[model samples]
Target chain A: MLEAREPMSAEAAEVSRPSRRGTLYRGDPGMWSWVAHRITGVLTFFFLFAHVLDTALVRVSPQAYNEIIETYKTPLVNLMEVGLVGAVLYHALNGVRVMLVDFWAKGPRYQKQMLWGILVVWLLVMVPGAYFMLVRTVTEMFGGS
Target chain B: MTLALDKPRTPRRPAARRNNWELASWVFMRVSGVALLVLVLGHLLIMNILDGGVHRINWGFVAGRWSSPFWQFWDLAMLWLAEIHGGNGLRTIINDYARKDATRFWLKVLLYVSMVLILALGTFVIFTFDPNFDA
Candidate 1:
C-alpha cells in the first residue's frame, strides 16, 4: 500500500528549498563565530558562578576548600581547563574583531580577514598554552623521569 | 490613477521612551571585552601556565595571592567586569531566542537574579577573605 505525505505550507516549502537565501545568516563564518561566542560566553558564566562558590569555601575551612579544589587537579578536569582556555581565548579574540567591525574606519571591509587572523593567533597561543597547562598532568601520569 | 502605498512598519517602542541604554550596552561590551582579554589572559597565565598549573592551587596558594592587595584588586576587578560582561551577553541571547513576552520576562528575571547573587557573593568573598583563617 502507498503511504500519503502531508502537504507542506509556504514557509516550510521555502525552508525545504535548497536556496542560499532561505536563512538570514545562512551559516556563514560570521554567524558561526557569533554562535561560538554565545556558547562560550554562557559556559564561562556558569563556570564563574561555580568558581566563586568554590572559592567561598575558604570561609568554611581550608580543608573544605582544598577538598573540592582537588577535583580540579585531576587529569580529566585538567583537560577541561585546557578546553576552557580555548573557549575564553576564542571569545576574547573574536570580541576584538567585533569591536573593530563596529568602530574602525575600514573594519567592516576586513571583518572576514580579521576573523581568519584571530583564528591564527588563537592557534599560536593555544598550542603552547595547552602544552604548559597539561605538562604536569602528562609528567605525573607517565612517571616523571 | 496613482497606486496606494503600503503603511510603514511600526516602531518597536515609542519615540518618547527612546534612550541610549542599548548604545551604552553595546559600547560597554566592547570596552569590557578588551579589558577582559588582558585581565583574563594574564590571570590564566599566572594561574594555569606558570610554575605548576592547578596542582599548585590550594588554600595556601590562594592565601598567598590574596595576601597582596594587588592580586586582591586584580581578582575583584576581574570578577565584577567578567560577570557584568557575561550577564549582558546572555541578556542579548535571551532577547534573540525567546519569542513570547512571558518567556522573555521570566528568563531575564532568572538571569538578573543569578547575576545579582553571583556579584554579591563574589564581592563579599573578596572583601572578607581571611588569609589567616586556618591559623
Candidate 2:
C-alpha cells in the first residue's frame, strides 16, 4: 500500500500551504529574544524622550521645574521607574550580545550562552537597583505622610 | 569553486542603486548603541542613584550641571544619537509590520515628525537655557 501511494500534485501542495502563524511562535528562542529586544528598545526610547522634555523644563523656570520634579517623585512614577530600569537593563545587555554576534567569530554559535550570561548579569544588577529604587522611593514618599 | 558546465546559466541582473543607506544605518545602530550604553548608564547612575537620587534633582541641580560645557555636550550627544537610533529602529519595524503602503507611509511620517520635534525642542532647551532668568 505504501509503495502504491502517489506523490502530492502541485494543486494539492498549493491548497495545503503552511500558515505564517506557525513560524511566528514556533518556540524559537532567537525569535522571542529579538521581539523582546525590539519592545524594550522602543519603551526605553519613549521614556528617555519624556525624561528629556521634563528636564528641559528647568530652562523655562525654576518653579515649573520644581513642580514637575515633585510630581515625578510620586509613588506612581517611582513604581514605573522599576519598569524603566528593567527595560534599560535588558536593552543594554542584549545590545552587547548583538554586538558580539556581529563582531566575534564564535558569537553566533554561542548566542544561547551569551543570552543566558546577559540574563544573569541583568538580574545581578537589576535586583539591587530595583530594591533601592522601590524601597527608597516608597519610604521617602509615604513614610513622612 | 568554479561553476560546473552542467549548471544552467542565468541572466545577470543589472546592479541596483549605488546609495549605501542600508549599510550606513546598520553601522550607525552598532556605534550609536555602544555610545548610548555608556551615556545612558551614567545618566541613570547620576539621576536615579547617586546623591539622593531623583529627589535631589532640581532646577539648581540641572543649572549647575549645564553650567559646564562637558555636561552640555554629553547630554546633547545623548539626545541626538538616541533619537536617531530609535527613529531608525522604529522605521524598520513599521516597514516590517505595516502591510499596507498607505499605513507604512503615514506611520513613518508621524515618526519623523515626532522625532524632529523632540530633537529640535531638546537641542533648543539645552543651548538656550538661562539659569538666571527669573520666573
Candidate 3:
C-alpha cells in the first residue's frame, strides 16, 4: 500500500487524512440512546404503516384477513414480534426519560442515571415478556403441554 | 470574579418573530408519548402476550372485539394518536437530515400523503368493519 501510494507525497496524505478526534462528539451514552430512539422510532413507524395496511384487510373478507394475519404466527415472525416489542419498549422507556429530562428541575443532572434506570426496567420487562411471547413458537418446536 | 461579556454570542429571536409551532410540537410529543406508552404497551401485552398470543388473533377475534363500543373507541383513539405521533416524529427526522429545500419539501409531502392515506384507510376500515360479513 505504501509503494502504491508513491505518487502522492507523505505530507499530502497526512494532511488529507480525516481528523479522528471528536468526529462523533465522543458518542456518550446520551447520544447513543438518542440514536437508538430515532432508529427504533423510524422502524416502528414503518411497521405501523404496514400494520395498518394488514389490519385493513379485515374489510375485504374474513378469509383475506385471516390469511394475511397467519404470517404473523410463524416462528420467524414471532421472533420479529419480540424484536418489535423490544424496540417499542425501549422507545417508550427512553421517551419517559426524555420527558423527565425536559420537564423536571434536576432532569439534566440525573439524565445519565435515568438512562441506566430505563435499561434496567427494560430488562425487567423484557425477560418475562420474551418468554411469554415466544411460548407458542417454543411449544410448537418442542412438544409441550 | 466574573468577567462581564458585552453581548451574547448568538442573539435570541425576538418574541414576536419566534414561532410557537415548534414548541407546540415539542409539547405534543411529550404528552402523546406518555399516552402511547400506556396505550401501546397495554395493547402489546393483551394482543401479544396474553393467552394464545398472536395465534388468537383472527377475523372472529377482531369482530368480537369491535362488537364492543369500548374497544372500538380504544382502537380509534390509538390509530389516530399513533399515526400523528409517528408522523410528527418523521417530520422532525426529515427536517434534521434533508439538507436541500426541495428534498425536504418533497420528503414532507410524501410523509403527509402517506399519513393521510393511512389515516383515511384505517378509519374507514374500523368504521365499516362488519363482523357478520359472510366469507
lDDT of 3 at A87: 98
Chain A TM-score of each model, in the order shown?
Answer: 0.81, 0.77, 0.82
Cα error, candidate 2, residue B63 (Å): 0.6
Q: What is the docking quality class of candidate 1? A: acceptable
Candidate 2, residues A1-145, lDDT tens digits: the string is 0110112334333543357545543534555667788899889777867887888788778998999998877788877877887888888888888887777877666777788999999999888887766666767667755
Cα lDDT of model 3 by residue, A34-122, tens digit: 88998999999999999999999999989999999999999999999999999999999988888877768777667778989999999
Candidate 3 lDDT at B83 equals 95
Top-down DockQ ranking: 1, 2, 3
**DockQ of each model vs. true complex:** 0.39, 0.38, 0.36
Query: Comparing 2 and 3 by DockQ, which wins?
Result: 2
Per-residue CA lDDT of candidate 1, range A45-144, in tens?
9888898889889878899999999999999999999999999999888888877777687776676688899999999999999999999889989999
For candidate 1 chain A, which ten residues in a row score worst on lDDT? Answer: A1-10
Candidate 2's residue-wise lDDT over B1-135, tens digit each?
354343344566455559878878888888998999999888887887666677788898888888899999999999999999989888888877899999999999999988998999999999999867766
Clashing residue pairs, backbone N/CA/C < 3 A, model 1: none
Which has the better TM-score: candidate 2, or candidate 3?
Answer: 3
